[model samples]
Target: MEETYLSAYVFKYGLEKALKKTGNIEEVTSRMIRDVSGGVRVEDDISPEGLIWIDGDNFNTWLKPKIGQCQADGSFKTVYQAAEHVAPDPYSIYPSSGKCTADGLVGADGKVRKNVI
Candidate 1:
């Protein structure tokens, strides 16, 4: 597959917070869903270093708490609590060239301390 470079911003508070603050989540999510479904091509645009232009829907999904109050009091504290389903899998992904590191996977959002190269 051809490589795609997305503008990235892996924030400590989480990308969803940034998206909500920017008021771009709805627009970004729409575009991302289309792209992931192969219905549209993702656009190349300028994004802040800590912010990445990727599948918004996937990122949104990744940010949600998997366990919620039902499973645990504060399961939402970390992404790993729901890594199996919450983390971005097929969308909002990193460059295929990035390697696995102690941080889990370099360049992958919400996984490492240094998310971008």
Candidate 2:
């Protein structure tokens, strides 16, 4: 089965809340992973693949909302590390910020119109 992962930030709040309510962090995290993965799509910004195109600005604005964190510093630490933590998976927690070293999509003309980075 393909592995899946989520941004720690995205699951942090929900995990904390579930822990408070049920005192079961592992179960909560498992359920969250399942819920997030279900019905996911490529166009969805949080999808694992889509994350590749996410820039620091977009990560702070979009991904942070689902996780309830404030905008990250320009250094891009939070998002990049989070993505790396969950690798080889079709999960959304991956980093998409411009600071990442991965290459992005190219246009039909063979020019790399990849994400900023």
Highest lDDT model number: 2
Residue-level lDDT of model 1, residues 1-117, one tens digit each, is 112223122232234554555568655454333334311223324321122233344333222233324346633332234333234464225456354432244443544444444
What is the C-alpha local distance difference test score of candidate 1? 0.35
What TM-score would each prediction reach against the true structure? 0.15, 0.22
Per-residue lDDT of 4-106 in model 2, one digit per residue for the tens?
3444434443455556666665556666543333222223444543432222222222231223234556322233333332222212343332122223333
The alpha-carbon lDDT assigned to residue 86 of candidate 1 equals 36
The number of the candidate with the highest TM-score is 2
After superposition, which runs of candidate 2 have C-alpha atoms over 4 Å from their true positions? Answer: 1-6, 26-29, 32-117
Q: Please list all clashing residue pairs in model 2, or write none if there are none.
A: 7-93, 54-96, 83-95
